[model samples]
Target: MEIIKINDFNNHTLSESDIIKRILSGEKELYEILLRRNNQKLYRVIRSYISNTAEIEDIMQNTYLKSYEKLYQFKHHSSYSTWLIRIGINEALARLKTKSKVLHLNTAQNLNSNSILERPDTSQLNPESKIIRKEAKQLLEKTIDSLDTKYKTVYILKEVEEMSIKDIANCLNISTANTKVRLHRAKHMLKEKLFEITTNVDIFEFGFSKCDDLTEKIMSIILKN
Candidate 1:
Protein backbone atom coordinates (compact mmCIF):
# COMPACT_ATOMS: atom_id res chain seq x y z
CA MET A 1 0.00 0.00 0.00
CA GLU A 2 1.27 3.43 -0.93
CA ILE A 3 1.05 6.26 1.60
CA ILE A 4 -0.32 9.49 0.21
CA LYS A 5 -0.35 12.94 1.80
CA ILE A 6 -3.72 14.63 1.43
CA ASN A 7 -2.10 17.96 2.28
CA ASP A 8 -0.10 17.60 -0.93
CA PHE A 9 -3.33 18.50 -2.66
CA ASN A 10 -4.43 22.06 -1.92
CA ASN A 11 -6.29 21.58 1.38
CA HIS A 12 -8.50 24.52 0.45
CA THR A 13 -9.35 22.99 -2.92
CA LEU A 14 -10.55 19.41 -2.47
CA SER A 15 -14.11 19.04 -1.24
CA GLU A 16 -15.39 16.04 0.69
CA SER A 17 -16.97 14.56 -2.46
CA ASP A 18 -13.70 14.84 -4.32
CA ILE A 19 -11.89 12.95 -1.57
CA ILE A 20 -14.66 10.35 -1.36
CA LYS A 21 -14.33 9.79 -5.07
CA ARG A 22 -10.59 9.36 -4.74
CA ILE A 23 -11.01 6.94 -1.82
CA LEU A 24 -13.50 4.89 -3.79
CA SER A 25 -11.14 4.89 -6.76
CA GLY A 26 -8.57 3.01 -4.59
CA GLU A 27 -6.60 5.83 -2.98
CA LYS A 28 -7.47 4.45 0.42
CA GLU A 29 -4.86 6.65 2.11
CA LEU A 30 -7.11 9.63 1.45
CA TYR A 31 -9.55 8.23 3.97
CA GLU A 32 -7.11 9.52 6.57
CA ILE A 33 -7.64 12.91 4.98
CA LEU A 34 -11.36 12.63 5.54
CA LEU A 35 -10.90 11.47 9.12
CA ARG A 36 -8.59 14.36 9.95
CA ARG A 37 -10.93 16.91 8.42
CA ASN A 38 -14.15 15.88 10.15
CA ASN A 39 -12.76 14.54 13.43
CA GLN A 40 -13.62 17.59 15.54
CA LYS A 41 -17.20 18.04 14.39
CA LEU A 42 -17.97 14.35 14.78
CA TYR A 43 -16.34 14.34 18.22
CA ARG A 44 -18.46 17.27 19.35
CA VAL A 45 -21.66 15.58 18.14
CA ILE A 46 -20.86 12.36 19.98
CA ARG A 47 -19.65 14.23 23.07
CA SER A 48 -23.03 15.93 23.31
CA TYR A 49 -24.68 12.55 24.00
CA ILE A 50 -22.24 10.84 26.38
CA SER A 51 -19.36 11.96 28.62
CA ASN A 52 -17.12 8.93 29.13
CA THR A 53 -13.81 9.54 27.35
CA ALA A 54 -13.25 5.86 26.57
CA GLU A 55 -16.82 5.39 25.34
CA ILE A 56 -16.58 8.50 23.20
CA GLU A 57 -13.39 7.21 21.59
CA ASP A 58 -14.94 3.78 20.98
CA ILE A 59 -18.07 5.27 19.41
CA MET A 60 -15.97 7.51 17.16
CA GLN A 61 -13.84 4.57 15.98
CA ASN A 62 -16.99 2.57 15.27
CA THR A 63 -18.49 5.54 13.47
CA TYR A 64 -15.62 5.68 11.00
CA LEU A 65 -15.73 1.92 10.36
CA LYS A 66 -19.51 1.89 9.86
CA SER A 67 -19.43 4.92 7.62
CA TYR A 68 -16.75 3.39 5.43
CA GLU A 69 -18.65 0.10 5.21
CA LYS A 70 -21.82 1.91 4.18
CA LEU A 71 -20.13 4.35 1.89
CA TYR A 72 -21.68 2.63 -1.10
CA GLN A 73 -25.18 3.35 0.20
CA PHE A 74 -24.62 7.05 0.74
CA LYS A 75 -26.52 9.02 -1.84
CA HIS A 76 -25.69 12.68 -2.51
CA HIS A 77 -28.99 13.78 -1.00
CA SER A 78 -27.14 15.53 1.85
CA SER A 79 -23.70 17.09 2.13
CA TYR A 80 -21.10 14.42 2.91
CA SER A 81 -20.33 16.07 6.25
CA THR A 82 -23.99 15.99 7.25
CA TRP A 83 -24.20 12.35 6.26
CA LEU A 84 -21.17 11.59 8.39
CA ILE A 85 -22.63 13.53 11.31
CA ARG A 86 -25.89 11.58 11.10
CA ILE A 87 -23.98 8.34 11.18
CA GLY A 88 -22.04 9.47 14.27
CA ILE A 89 -25.13 10.75 16.05
CA ASN A 90 -27.06 7.56 15.35
CA GLU A 91 -24.22 5.37 16.57
CA ALA A 92 -23.99 7.35 19.82
CA LEU A 93 -27.74 7.11 20.35
CA ALA A 94 -27.66 3.35 19.78
CA ARG A 95 -24.97 2.94 22.42
CA LEU A 96 -27.00 5.07 24.83
CA LYS A 97 -30.06 2.83 24.44
CA THR A 98 -28.08 -0.24 25.38
CA LYS A 99 -26.70 1.26 28.58
CA SER A 100 -28.87 1.79 31.66
CA LYS A 101 -26.68 4.36 33.40
CA VAL A 102 -26.58 8.04 32.52
CA LEU A 103 -23.17 9.59 31.86
CA HIS A 104 -21.98 12.95 33.19
CA LEU A 105 -20.58 15.75 31.12
CA ASN A 106 -16.82 16.47 31.40
CA THR A 107 -17.77 19.37 33.68
CA ALA A 108 -15.60 22.40 34.48
CA GLN A 109 -12.55 20.42 35.55
CA ASN A 110 -11.73 18.71 32.28
CA LEU A 111 -12.84 21.80 30.41
CA ASN A 112 -10.15 23.93 32.12
CA SER A 113 -13.03 26.27 32.68
CA ASN A 114 -11.09 28.44 35.10
CA SER A 115 -7.78 28.74 33.28
CA ILE A 116 -8.68 32.03 31.70
CA LEU A 117 -9.83 33.55 34.96
CA GLU A 118 -6.75 32.39 36.84
CA ARG A 119 -4.50 34.67 34.82
CA PRO A 120 -5.49 38.30 34.84
CA ASP A 121 -3.28 41.01 33.35
CA THR A 122 -4.51 44.59 33.11
CA SER A 123 -2.44 45.34 30.01
CA GLN A 124 -3.69 42.36 28.03
CA LEU A 125 -7.31 42.30 26.93
CA ASN A 126 -6.99 38.97 25.16
CA PRO A 127 -7.01 37.14 28.44
CA GLU A 128 -10.23 38.88 29.41
CA SER A 129 -11.77 37.92 26.06
CA LYS A 130 -10.61 34.35 26.56
CA ILE A 131 -12.07 34.31 30.02
CA ILE A 132 -15.40 35.54 28.74
CA ARG A 133 -15.34 32.96 26.00
CA LYS A 134 -14.45 30.17 28.41
CA GLU A 135 -17.17 31.20 30.85
CA ALA A 136 -19.72 31.37 28.04
CA LYS A 137 -18.75 27.91 26.86
CA GLN A 138 -19.11 26.53 30.35
CA LEU A 139 -22.53 28.15 30.71
CA LEU A 140 -23.65 26.81 27.35
CA GLU A 141 -22.61 23.30 28.25
CA LYS A 142 -24.34 23.55 31.60
CA THR A 143 -27.50 24.79 29.95
CA ILE A 144 -27.44 22.04 27.34
CA ASP A 145 -26.93 19.40 30.02
CA SER A 146 -30.01 20.62 31.82
CA LEU A 147 -32.19 19.97 28.80
CA ASP A 148 -33.92 16.62 28.31
CA THR A 149 -32.23 14.22 25.92
CA LYS A 150 -34.68 14.87 23.07
CA TYR A 151 -34.37 18.61 23.36
CA LYS A 152 -30.63 18.45 23.96
CA THR A 153 -30.06 16.34 20.85
CA VAL A 154 -32.24 18.61 18.76
CA TYR A 155 -30.59 21.71 20.15
CA ILE A 156 -27.07 20.49 19.50
CA LEU A 157 -27.92 19.36 15.97
CA LYS A 158 -29.66 22.59 15.08
CA GLU A 159 -27.54 25.09 16.98
CA VAL A 160 -24.12 23.48 17.33
CA GLU A 161 -24.03 21.48 14.09
CA GLU A 162 -25.89 24.25 12.28
CA MET A 163 -28.02 21.56 10.66
CA SER A 164 -31.31 22.44 9.04
CA ILE A 165 -34.62 21.65 10.72
CA LYS A 166 -35.66 19.23 8.01
CA ASP A 167 -32.28 17.50 8.07
CA ILE A 168 -32.41 17.19 11.83
CA ALA A 169 -35.92 15.75 11.63
CA ASN A 170 -34.79 13.23 9.05
CA CYS A 171 -31.67 12.32 10.99
CA LEU A 172 -33.58 11.80 14.23
CA ASN A 173 -36.48 9.97 12.53
CA ILE A 174 -38.96 12.55 13.77
CA SER A 175 -41.48 14.72 11.96
CA THR A 176 -40.56 18.27 10.98
CA ALA A 177 -43.25 19.76 13.18
CA ASN A 178 -42.00 17.74 16.13
CA THR A 179 -38.50 18.86 15.42
CA LYS A 180 -39.58 22.49 15.32
CA VAL A 181 -41.48 22.17 18.57
CA ARG A 182 -38.59 20.50 20.29
CA LEU A 183 -36.19 23.15 19.04
CA HIS A 184 -38.45 25.91 20.25
CA ARG A 185 -38.74 24.31 23.65
CA ALA A 186 -35.02 23.78 23.77
CA LYS A 187 -34.30 27.40 23.00
CA HIS A 188 -36.73 28.43 25.67
CA MET A 189 -35.05 26.18 28.22
CA LEU A 190 -31.62 27.49 27.26
CA LYS A 191 -32.83 31.04 27.59
CA GLU A 192 -34.16 30.31 31.05
CA LYS A 193 -30.90 28.69 32.04
CA LEU A 194 -28.61 31.21 30.39
CA PHE A 195 -30.43 34.44 31.05
CA GLU A 196 -27.28 36.06 32.36
CA ILE A 197 -25.03 35.23 29.40
CA THR A 198 -25.11 36.93 26.00
CA THR A 199 -22.23 35.84 23.80
CA ASN A 200 -21.84 32.72 21.64
CA VAL A 201 -18.90 30.45 22.35
CA ASP A 202 -18.51 26.89 21.13
CA ILE A 203 -18.07 24.21 23.76
CA PHE A 204 -16.99 20.56 23.82
CA GLU A 205 -14.01 21.02 21.57
CA PHE A 206 -11.88 17.92 20.83
CA GLY A 207 -8.32 18.77 21.82
CA PHE A 208 -5.64 18.76 19.12
CA SER A 209 -3.65 15.94 20.75
CA LYS A 210 -6.71 13.69 20.96
CA CYS A 211 -7.72 14.53 17.39
CA ASP A 212 -4.31 13.54 16.02
CA ASP A 213 -4.18 10.39 18.14
CA LEU A 214 -7.63 9.24 16.98
CA THR A 215 -6.83 10.01 13.38
CA GLU A 216 -3.64 7.93 13.57
CA LYS A 217 -5.46 5.05 15.29
CA ILE A 218 -8.30 5.05 12.77
CA MET A 219 -5.90 5.17 9.85
CA SER A 220 -3.93 2.28 11.28
CA ILE A 221 -7.10 0.21 11.65
CA ILE A 222 -8.27 1.01 8.14
CA LEU A 223 -4.92 0.06 6.70
CA LYS A 224 -4.76 -3.16 8.71
CA ASN A 225 -8.26 -4.31 7.78
Candidate 2:
Protein backbone atom coordinates (compact mmCIF):
# COMPACT_ATOMS: atom_id res chain seq x y z
CA MET A 1 0.00 0.00 0.00
CA GLU A 2 3.02 2.30 -0.06
CA ILE A 3 2.57 5.29 -2.38
CA ILE A 4 5.21 6.94 -4.54
CA LYS A 5 6.08 10.35 -3.13
CA ILE A 6 6.46 13.33 -5.42
CA ASN A 7 10.06 13.97 -4.38
CA ASP A 8 11.01 10.46 -5.55
CA PHE A 9 11.39 11.77 -9.10
CA ASN A 10 14.28 14.14 -9.76
CA ASN A 11 12.88 15.29 -13.10
CA HIS A 12 9.53 16.90 -12.33
CA THR A 13 8.90 17.96 -15.93
CA LEU A 14 8.55 14.55 -17.58
CA SER A 15 5.99 14.55 -20.34
CA GLU A 16 3.11 12.07 -20.34
CA SER A 17 4.77 10.06 -23.09
CA ASP A 18 8.03 9.99 -21.14
CA ILE A 19 6.24 8.70 -18.08
CA ILE A 20 4.38 6.12 -20.14
CA LYS A 21 7.68 4.96 -21.64
CA ARG A 22 9.15 4.60 -18.17
CA ILE A 23 6.15 2.62 -16.95
CA LEU A 24 6.36 0.37 -19.98
CA SER A 25 10.06 -0.01 -19.26
CA GLY A 26 9.25 -1.56 -15.85
CA GLU A 27 8.83 1.53 -13.73
CA LYS A 28 5.36 0.48 -12.60
CA GLU A 29 5.15 3.17 -9.90
CA LEU A 30 5.25 5.87 -12.53
CA TYR A 31 1.75 4.86 -13.52
CA GLU A 32 0.47 6.44 -10.34
CA ILE A 33 1.69 9.80 -11.54
CA LEU A 34 -0.61 9.61 -14.55
CA LEU A 35 -3.49 8.49 -12.38
CA ARG A 36 -3.04 11.38 -9.99
CA ARG A 37 -2.74 13.81 -12.86
CA ASN A 38 -5.90 12.77 -14.70
CA ASN A 39 -8.10 11.50 -11.87
CA GLN A 40 -10.14 14.70 -11.60
CA LYS A 41 -10.83 14.81 -15.34
CA LEU A 42 -11.76 11.14 -15.40
CA TYR A 43 -13.89 11.51 -12.27
CA ARG A 44 -15.87 14.38 -13.74
CA VAL A 45 -16.51 12.45 -16.97
CA ILE A 46 -17.64 9.42 -15.03
CA ARG A 47 -19.70 11.48 -12.58
CA SER A 48 -21.73 12.97 -15.41
CA TYR A 49 -23.15 9.51 -16.05
CA ILE A 50 -23.15 8.22 -12.47
CA SER A 51 -24.88 9.93 -9.56
CA ASN A 52 -23.53 7.73 -6.79
CA THR A 53 -20.09 8.72 -5.51
CA ALA A 54 -19.08 5.14 -4.71
CA GLU A 55 -20.15 3.92 -8.14
CA ILE A 56 -18.18 6.71 -9.77
CA GLU A 57 -15.08 5.65 -7.83
CA ASP A 58 -15.64 2.03 -8.83
CA ILE A 59 -15.88 2.99 -12.49
CA MET A 60 -12.81 5.16 -12.15
CA GLN A 61 -10.94 2.12 -10.91
CA ASN A 62 -12.26 0.12 -13.83
CA THR A 63 -11.27 2.85 -16.28
CA TYR A 64 -7.70 2.85 -14.95
CA LEU A 65 -7.55 -0.91 -14.97
CA LYS A 66 -8.82 -1.15 -18.51
CA SER A 67 -6.46 1.54 -19.72
CA TYR A 68 -3.50 -0.19 -18.11
CA GLU A 69 -4.43 -3.50 -19.61
CA LYS A 70 -4.75 -1.92 -23.03
CA LEU A 71 -1.83 0.46 -22.76
CA TYR A 72 0.11 -1.38 -25.41
CA GLN A 73 -2.70 -0.78 -27.85
CA PHE A 74 -2.51 2.98 -27.40
CA LYS A 75 -0.93 4.41 -30.52
CA HIS A 76 0.73 7.77 -29.89
CA HIS A 77 -1.40 9.43 -32.57
CA SER A 78 -3.17 11.58 -30.00
CA SER A 79 -2.20 13.11 -26.67
CA TYR A 80 -2.14 10.67 -23.75
CA SER A 81 -4.84 12.60 -21.92
CA THR A 82 -7.23 12.40 -24.87
CA TRP A 83 -6.61 8.68 -25.25
CA LEU A 84 -7.11 8.14 -21.53
CA ILE A 85 -10.34 10.14 -21.54
CA ARG A 86 -11.76 8.20 -24.51
CA ILE A 87 -11.38 5.04 -22.44
CA GLY A 88 -12.99 6.70 -19.41
CA ILE A 89 -15.98 8.01 -21.38
CA ASN A 90 -16.57 4.63 -22.97
CA GLU A 91 -16.38 2.92 -19.58
CA ALA A 92 -18.82 5.38 -18.05
CA LEU A 93 -21.28 4.95 -20.90
CA ALA A 94 -21.07 1.16 -20.67
CA ARG A 95 -21.86 1.34 -16.95
CA LEU A 96 -24.72 3.71 -17.63
CA LYS A 97 -26.31 1.19 -19.98
CA THR A 98 -26.22 -1.52 -17.32
CA LYS A 99 -28.42 0.37 -14.90
CA SER A 100 -32.21 0.03 -15.38
CA LYS A 101 -32.60 3.61 -16.35
CA VAL A 102 -35.04 5.31 -18.65
CA LEU A 103 -33.91 7.67 -21.40
CA HIS A 104 -34.74 10.57 -19.10
CA LEU A 105 -32.52 11.90 -16.37
CA ASN A 106 -32.19 9.75 -13.30
CA THR A 107 -32.17 11.57 -9.99
CA ALA A 108 -30.03 10.50 -7.07
CA GLN A 109 -28.75 11.75 -3.75
CA ASN A 110 -26.90 15.07 -3.72
CA LEU A 111 -23.12 14.81 -4.25
CA ASN A 112 -22.65 18.53 -3.53
CA SER A 113 -23.31 18.19 0.18
CA ASN A 114 -19.70 17.02 0.60
CA SER A 115 -18.40 20.16 -1.21
CA ILE A 116 -15.69 18.76 -3.46
CA LEU A 117 -15.95 21.87 -5.66
CA GLU A 118 -12.60 23.61 -5.98
CA ARG A 119 -12.95 27.19 -4.83
CA PRO A 120 -11.35 29.65 -7.20
CA ASP A 121 -8.46 31.65 -5.72
CA THR A 122 -10.34 34.42 -3.98
CA SER A 123 -7.59 35.95 -1.86
CA GLN A 124 -8.52 39.49 -2.78
CA LEU A 125 -12.27 38.95 -2.67
CA ASN A 126 -14.28 39.54 0.49
CA PRO A 127 -15.88 36.63 2.37
CA GLU A 128 -19.36 37.76 1.29
CA SER A 129 -18.52 37.34 -2.41
CA LYS A 130 -17.12 33.89 -1.76
CA ILE A 131 -20.33 32.84 -0.04
CA ILE A 132 -22.41 34.15 -2.94
CA ARG A 133 -20.27 32.29 -5.46
CA LYS A 134 -20.53 29.08 -3.42
CA GLU A 135 -24.32 29.25 -3.45
CA ALA A 136 -24.33 29.93 -7.20
CA LYS A 137 -22.05 26.98 -7.88
CA GLN A 138 -24.30 24.70 -5.83
CA LEU A 139 -27.32 25.81 -7.80
CA LEU A 140 -25.55 25.18 -11.09
CA GLU A 141 -24.50 21.72 -9.91
CA LYS A 142 -28.12 20.90 -9.07
CA THR A 143 -29.32 22.13 -12.45
CA ILE A 144 -26.71 20.04 -14.26
CA ASP A 145 -27.84 17.04 -12.30
CA SER A 146 -31.30 17.53 -13.78
CA LEU A 147 -30.23 17.52 -17.45
CA ASP A 148 -31.06 14.51 -19.63
CA THR A 149 -28.27 11.96 -19.75
CA LYS A 150 -27.28 12.63 -23.35
CA TYR A 151 -27.19 16.40 -22.95
CA LYS A 152 -25.43 16.09 -19.60
CA THR A 153 -22.75 13.85 -21.02
CA VAL A 154 -22.12 16.11 -24.00
CA TYR A 155 -22.14 19.21 -21.82
CA ILE A 156 -19.67 17.81 -19.32
CA LEU A 157 -17.34 16.59 -22.04
CA LYS A 158 -17.45 19.85 -23.96
CA GLU A 159 -17.56 22.34 -21.10
CA VAL A 160 -16.03 20.68 -18.07
CA GLU A 161 -13.38 18.62 -19.84
CA GLU A 162 -12.74 21.34 -22.44
CA MET A 163 -12.29 18.69 -25.09
CA SER A 164 -12.44 19.65 -28.74
CA ILE A 165 -15.54 18.77 -30.72
CA LYS A 166 -13.56 16.43 -32.93
CA ASP A 167 -12.12 14.65 -29.90
CA ILE A 168 -15.51 14.45 -28.25
CA ALA A 169 -16.99 13.05 -31.42
CA ASN A 170 -14.25 10.45 -31.68
CA CYS A 171 -14.67 9.55 -28.05
CA LEU A 172 -18.43 9.29 -28.28
CA ASN A 173 -18.40 7.54 -31.69
CA ILE A 174 -20.50 10.23 -33.30
CA SER A 175 -19.89 12.50 -36.27
CA THR A 176 -18.14 15.82 -35.63
CA ALA A 177 -21.14 17.81 -36.86
CA ASN A 178 -23.43 15.75 -34.64
CA THR A 179 -21.17 16.42 -31.71
CA LYS A 180 -21.37 20.15 -32.36
CA VAL A 181 -25.13 19.91 -32.63
CA ARG A 182 -25.40 18.17 -29.29
CA LEU A 183 -23.08 20.67 -27.66
CA HIS A 184 -25.14 23.56 -29.03
CA ARG A 185 -28.33 21.96 -27.81
CA ALA A 186 -26.81 21.27 -24.42
CA LYS A 187 -25.77 24.89 -24.05
CA HIS A 188 -29.23 26.14 -24.90
CA MET A 189 -30.82 23.65 -22.50
CA LEU A 190 -28.48 24.70 -19.73
CA LYS A 191 -29.27 28.34 -20.36
CA GLU A 192 -32.98 27.66 -20.01
CA LYS A 193 -32.37 25.42 -17.00
CA LEU A 194 -30.31 28.07 -15.23
CA PHE A 195 -32.21 31.13 -16.45
CA GLU A 196 -33.81 31.74 -13.09
CA ILE A 197 -30.48 31.45 -11.31
CA THR A 198 -28.45 34.53 -12.20
CA THR A 199 -25.00 33.40 -11.24
CA ASN A 200 -22.15 32.31 -13.51
CA VAL A 201 -20.53 29.09 -12.25
CA ASP A 202 -18.09 26.34 -12.92
CA ILE A 203 -18.91 22.67 -13.25
CA PHE A 204 -17.48 19.42 -11.93
CA GLU A 205 -16.36 19.22 -8.28
CA PHE A 206 -13.66 16.60 -7.62
CA GLY A 207 -11.76 17.20 -4.40
CA PHE A 208 -8.02 16.49 -4.25
CA SER A 209 -8.35 14.28 -1.18
CA LYS A 210 -11.07 12.15 -2.74
CA CYS A 211 -9.17 12.06 -6.02
CA ASP A 212 -6.01 10.86 -4.22
CA ASP A 213 -7.95 8.12 -2.42
CA LEU A 214 -9.46 6.89 -5.67
CA THR A 215 -6.11 6.98 -7.43
CA GLU A 216 -4.57 4.90 -4.63
CA LYS A 217 -7.44 2.43 -4.72
CA ILE A 218 -7.13 2.13 -8.49
CA MET A 219 -3.37 1.65 -8.30
CA SER A 220 -3.73 -1.04 -5.65
CA ILE A 221 -6.07 -2.94 -7.94
CA ILE A 222 -3.69 -2.48 -10.88
CA LEU A 223 -0.69 -3.76 -8.90
CA LYS A 224 -2.60 -6.84 -7.86
CA ASN A 225 -3.12 -7.84 -11.48
| Clashes found in each candidate (C-alpha, N, C closer than 3 A) | 0, 0
Any runs in candidate 1 off by more than 4 Å, and if so which?
Answer: 1-12, 101-124, 196-225
The Cα error of candidate 1 at residue 55, in Å, is: 1.5
Off by over 4 Å in 2: 1-12, 101-106, 114-119, 196-225
Q: Please provide TM-scores, in order, for all candidate models, with all chains considered together.
A: 0.68, 0.74
Task: Estimate, for each residue in 1-225, the C-alpha lDDT of model 2 and write its tens digit.
Answer: 334568745444777787887778788888888887788777777777777888888888998998888887878877777788778878777777766475554555656453334545848767556666776777778788778767777788788777888877777778989988888888898898787554434332543344556788999999999
- Candidate 2, residue 155: lDDT: 84
Work out candidate 2's RMSD over C-alphas: 13.9
Question: Which window of 10 residues has the lowest lDDT sum in candidate 1?
Answer: 111-120
Clashing pairs in 1: none
